[model samples]
Target: MPQHRALLIGASNYDMRGIHSLPFIPGDLARLGSALRRRGFKDVQVLSQLEGGKQLGANFIKGCVAGFLRRAGRGDTLVIVLSGHGVHAAGRDYLVPEDIHEDTHPFESGCVPIDWGRDLDETPADHVVFLIDACREGIEVASMSVAGVTQWGRQKTDAALRRKVAYVYGCSPAQLSLYVRDHEAVTDGVQCGTVPGESFSIFSRAISDVVTSHQGALALDVFREAVQERVSLLHQAYRKRGNPQLLRTITDIPHNAFTFLPAAAGRHEAATPPVTEYPATPSRSTSPWWSTPASPPSGLRPQPALTRTAEEDRLIPPAPSHSAAPGRGQAAGPVGLPPRLRGSSPGPRHLISRRRVLLGLAGTVLTGVGFTAWKVIDASTPDRQLWKFNTREFVQSSPAVAGGVVYVGSGDGKLYAVDAATGEEHWSFATGEWDASSPSDSAVKSSPAVADGVVYVGSQNKKLYAVDAATGKKRWSFATGGEVYSSPAVAGGVVYVGSRDEKLYAVDAATGDERWSFATGDRVDSSPTVTKGVVYVGSSNDKLYAVDAATGDERWSFATDFHVESSPTVADGVVYIGSYDAHLYAVKT
Candidate 1:
């Protein structure tokens, strides 16, 4: 069964020395938790008001977030919500923890920087959403001056989650999120989250209302626009200066629908039996994407024709605009959504329209007995599991498939050779006792690179081993200055790999003799990709080097904020690699 987890954090009343004190954050914590629980999140952790509405330190929050992420498996869904004071310094934005000490050595910001994914190589959750109810920079709302120094904190959540991620920011990068005191007045255009005398922030309250409403399962794009319109309208009506922003940079967007439905909506899903087994390939064609021609959202009925005219395709609707009160003095709360959408609706950023497809699905076969496809307009690729093998610990190493045998390394400190057809274990070679009595950090996590009849791989014990691919037996071992986290790439007579010792080495493929080595500024974990006698790799020092494959001499280098651990993949004349800064770059040779 797929798991659903939520981490809701509200840090108010922070240690005044290091951070500002917010009194109403407890309300946000409680309200957001209730909203997520209502939306069918089975595992919800709400941490706020610890020791009477005040957490002691930043470590507490980090430990909790790490633990929460650890609980989520690859097939799970995770939602993380944060509400509190936020600070931006230099070029990075940070979520202020209770004990942030900006004046200390290395400035232990007592904060969680947006680079929270630095500690994670991968995550198990397939769908992760982040809802931030804090401003990017600090501002004096009473006055009209901004006090913060840098841009707001943003998450490369898509890269970290290794899945689909949607983010909703409370305010614009340079704006401050306001917390207004309630004044009882007429609220015809007011939304449901804020009340006459409520203390909730305008953004958080709006988020709760939308997630619990009938449109709870709104498509990601529509949902983003809807939330933006709601928050923007409310802020504008109240004469507040903040605007909500949604950042989704990943390309090749899918049409899958994402609904954070209410718990009552989940009760029906919970009653269904779990799927214990599945056939690799289904006989029938079953895709969440549409095979039939799209019909317009005229009403809840099928179309007379399969195709639409070009003129009709261009009939896209503009986003409906709401009028703000003439005297902008805190005009209204959030905008309330009706059971069925009304007024004007806008389309997706890339698609023709989300409302059009959603409204059209009412009469189609897509509104199935149980599952409803989120993105029903595009054709979805077939998804199926080929095989499975448990490796005791995490499998950070990529598998090398050769001669019908799949060679992979695990955190268990073992290299496994499994049958490619049936996933049965053929043999295993242990370099340490990582799964047994060895230290937790010890393991054989390097990917195996096969060439000729030898399997070249790195180990955590600071050694590179050449194992016989067919027999899983060690042929030779070469020592390095640091752990061998880089996967080996074989070209010509050289086996090239990088080590955490801040060097890339070229060793003889058969004899294990060190032929040449190149030094870099920091650790080199990126596996080498060879193309046209040029060896390409990235380093912790934020650079991608193109070196002479034969002489290990400097060719040319491209610099980036390359917290790069990704192996460079060469295709045609491009070298593709990913960095911690959340960019997948393609460099031309």
Candidate 2:
């Protein structure tokens, strides 16, 4: 008897900087696994980051692929599903691992090459199906350019596969198979979200719909037509100028290869009832779509344990990172304000403007002491004092006032929260320690951004941290190549910040995963201001840049005579920023 086996690998969270995390991959894997089972794929194995701390590195993925292929002998039908970042470089297709970095060489050891020699053709399976769902844009690396997704040309695919094989890509070599949440409304038939609803890529959802809904022998042409129709409808629902990602496949496999009919069944087992749901409909049965069946027969064998040679380990080592050091100790003390902020220290009563008073207060707060609550003099009463909260070091990072709580960062590598009314310390979170002897390396100069109960800030120790606003518990940390003096701006579930590595990065607010990065000529100490889907930030390279918040692509930049350290302020479609050249620039958006 012929057995059906499947190996599905989905990479949702990426640690690398250039590639963004795909929140939909887990869902895609579940939906496809269910669909394959319904079509009689008995042995389904999945490998993903959802397994917890396990990293889907290049060597691990290659080992899994080899192990799965070895078990698929003659007369077996094998399905290999790869859902993640893929690329085409040097005329070869490569599946990018989650740990692959921008500087890693793709063709060498960082990526798994999809070729005929070892990945597919070497397998003894009678029938093989390869499915991929990834972006198809061009990736710019170093000085050379490569395709962001697998681009299997017709001629190349034809020459590569000699056996009964089917190669299907979710999109053309120029489109991205979108996620269900990207649309205004989720389609009725497609499953989405992080729970049982599994977020699937649009292309995988369509295929699952066709396979699960159909009850009888499914013809190859019919399956193709159904999937194409679903994809077309989904593209229209995207509402992004009708950007359609048509299915692209090059196959010579027989129609019966994908059908679930028994050997004794006739040419057409039965016509399934008409499924009314558009864009990947579910079955009419009331049972859950993800319900599983009983175990396979005893003859079914398990795949071999994943193994890697010494050479493989030497060539593809774990991804390197320059993580920040751990915090030293916890201290509790009263935060204080400099005495200069006290308005009562007057030899002569001089008129002080409100702006001047606030400026003086800020100047005093940043003078390497604690924060203070000072009372300004008024005509109704004399000058007074409320309270003071002190940290062990300088309080340079401005405080964020939210929900009657004040959040601020100090040069001592700690973020403190205090009650706005009582000036009492609530909690303190130590970001990390670097060199205590060098204040610049230990300071948290970036002001905090509090959003959705999370406080985001950057430290001089070359990292950004997401901490709980109320409890001061650390959520996650992201490492950059250099010191991060730039404050973070949170918008649309993304955090944008700058680093001394001359790059501005956009990270996922919840997971602290890098979405994208935009490079500049010099260090980027100036903070970023995000508004209207645009991020305006200044760089030490003597330029202020406007970048697309979602893609990290540069929109425009204004050059100044000297470095621009002032954070940009956008109002009435104009960006206002100051530079060291003794000028405040106001550029139209």
Candidate 3:
């Protein structure tokens, strides 16, 4: 088998003066490196701020090109993962390196413009996967923000370097990447208070999760879906907090090749399929009686005709006005009522007053009777119908549906219990951070899993918490090496969770005691799904492992084409997963 190579860049520290705090760029890069390594990439290079670099601009491009040239050949693939600040200018997007100074423009002091194929020259890689987690600056955020930048860089003058590259962005050009507090802290300290930055870059985290979970099934469409879902979740979380203004941007390169496909070769097709059109509806007239008009009532008097010859009428004739008629102007007609004395029988005024009084009495009686009947019916009606909760946010986590209630976690850092039938919120538990504790400049992106009346969830706070399911009250929490982006899975009286700390933790179900932990090369955000005697999970390490559920011993492992952030779903006797390599895999024990 040909050796695979990858270059992962995570820039957490900028040259600009700011608080040197927890940024997820480094963590994301670490996870990417781990995932790629697990996928059998013999050489995976991770460049982070911790590595100490001032010329990251030259270093990143150089590293990527070198890696590409080193391992890239016919039938070989090269993957590049970048998690950092990205901005667009003059309609072009640029990824910020670790040494970039926010105060300076890209052309002046930051990384100069480089096309997507800048490093592909002399390399004959079959596929090039580019994952960029950054914010795109200028565009409409609402519609486009849900999906990261999907437009790839156009082929430029560098024909020698131009090759097949698949790109995935974190957000669209108009949206902002968010950063929030972790889910575990209650005190208002630096570690417990609001972190002032975009927390989880939606595109980065989604790519990490999808690539890790799917394990070799990371196609273009699947990657877009995962990113879009995360963006939607972030948008909803911000909207619920009355901060809809936060947005992010995502863009891709070789945009033509970035499409959802069932297999790797499916991405090679060049043309976009035509959209289907629907027929128009027929028009109709608004008037109810367009064909005819109503006729006048019968028994009305007709006017008399005049008699005169044309020459005689023109020559002579005059009338005596006094002999015509008396009180002719005051006669009753259809247009007016007859003049009546004060006590005249059935006068119009008298009739109107009587009718008004009768109508008032009848209306009052009917209103009272109707209200009483409605109240009785309402009281007798049952309120047991299933309720639909339409959250603008993505419920990425599976909800615990029990006790006539649905318990789930939101990226907004709240654990909500809604009436399953009515969709009404019964109670909520707030974890004052984004679900994914990336940095103060990132967003929370984890989900809660409930079992045994206790909710087990991981947070950006770098901790796994066990809370009372019914009350939304915290029972106990255990700090980990890194942020806990993985959902908790319970089986065999134990809880399993993976954390950014690069370890899979097995905790006691009753008490928050650490039973054992299996350390991976990178972050393990892929949640574990237990089967008959095995636990199947993917890791940023890019390997899907079937481990002994009781001992955490590796039973069988499969390598993918790229990072595996995808959580494994086991059905029948087969395990299905996706990978950032743009391939979905099905493995059988």
Candidate 4:
């Protein structure tokens, strides 16, 4: 394997209140750096405010560019990780450095904005991984005004360098990052003097674990599963203590590979089984009519053969009908006349034969009718109920059905698995936060979407999460520009979603890599509807956009009255969406 180069930065101080409490800054950075070096990263640089300098911003950026120039090559990988407070101003994401002042604007401050497109061109590497751990402004929290605001800043190098880049963030714009007391260390017997407000960030821990445990399994899909599992566990542990929510956002450059695995030996397994057996017998019988024998009365007598002239038999005259013999008087002949009693009536046996034939015909007709009825009933019957379970919170989202299970997110900040047929809960993973953003006061308002064995969902805390559908394990998470009210739509190895931060993000479904993004004028409450290479989403700005799913380019946009928060449902060459203006609009593609 080729050696990779990385520049890691962690900021522990902030000009803003309640944002500068990172006690494990040095430990986290050192641990991460050592881990990366062990994983074949030949050149890894770590920088932090603890190094001591008011010029930290200038020094960090200079170091990053220098590292890139020194080790980055056409085929080499460059990873940049930043952990600090993040703020958004004038529609741009900024990673706040410890030395950054209240007056420092993102453009002026050393902060890296979400639109780091300029940096992508300046760095020469096959793949660039940009990780930011911070709170995004203009999102979940209210914006603050600093006295004596400074003007925007500019990048020193303007040279365009085309390179693949993957950007990952810690929380959605509309959400806040959580920190908890150092419970893990305490449980592990590590002791430090009375430390007030000592805690670990849920997402940070999950990321570290993924990089450490999975080793070469660094794809987005694998990472997401691990992170979701951890986050769920943490959520359950601190539900009563008010833990912070974790959100994730990602962007990936075209043809960029983040994981170390070769394409020939992909992580996903090949398909094998075609169908699964039902837990219980099906509601209807599976046997065909020929498989079972029918029972008939043994007392019935056999009918006599008809006697006719040779010429008449060849002509095949219709059988004659006759009334029953009067009180067992005389038997009727097969030709319909009374049997000759030397000119008298027919015998009782003749009458009995006629009755037997009539009864057999009736029975045949009835059996045919009965079989038809059975077929109809079986076709209409529903499958048997297999399982059922309940959650502590209410479930507002539709469940994702896969592998004989139903995966759902609940308002209680937990992802639950119930038997699809029986509704029995197989397992539940907590997300560590409540969803206060839903219109209803339900436990989980976002439905879970499952693909490739991973469940993806958003919460009221303005975060999107991915969990293992089978074991409820945490995977990787990417923060978004805003609260992830919309469920994710996965296709073509990518996941698409909208955020209240007013942007649509396309992330690699496998590795949480950001592919592309498109901005809207207002909040994007509508979940993206993808089809035939196009993405359709509604915005609070009252417009419907048709964008190329691959490139995130705008194909067309249609304006409507009022905000369009309802997710667009696409089918039959038509896009149907609802608007807060009290109307539903149908658009033909």
Best by TM-score: 1
Which candidate, 1 or 4, would have the higher lDDT against the true structure?
1
lDDT scores of the candidates, listed in order = 0.59, 0.64, 0.50, 0.53
| RMSD values, in order shown | 14.2, 28.2, 30.5, 32.4
**Pairwise TM-score winner, candidates 3 and 4:** 4
lDDT of 1 at 409: 81
TM-score of each: 0.49, 0.42, 0.39, 0.42
lDDT of 4 by residue, 180-278 (tens): 544422211111111223345555654553443332434444345445554444443334243334334333222212453212122133521121211
Judge candidate 2 at residue 378 and give its lDDT. 42
lDDT of 4: 0.53
* lDDT tens per residue, model 1, 163-224: 25555567644456666554432234332333344455667655654553322345455555
After aligning candidate 4 to the native by TM-score, how far in Å is the CA of 543 from where it should be?
5.9
Per-residue lDDT over 249-309 for candidate 2, one digit per residue giving the tens place of the 0 to 100 score: 6553433224422221121335322223122122234222121123211232111111223
Could you tell me the C-alpha RMSD of candidate 2 in Å?
28.2
Among all windows of 10 consecutive residues in model 2, the one with the lowest summed lDDT is 328-337
Q: Write the per-residue lDDT of candidate 3 for residues 317-411, one digit (tens) a residue.
A: 22223331231111111110111111112212111111223322212211110011011123234431222454323344455566766666654
By lDDT: ranked, best first: 2, 1, 4, 3
Clashes of each: 12, 7, 69, 55
Q: lDDT (0-100) at residue 273 of candidate 4? A: 14
Worst 10 residues of 3 by lDDT: 365-374
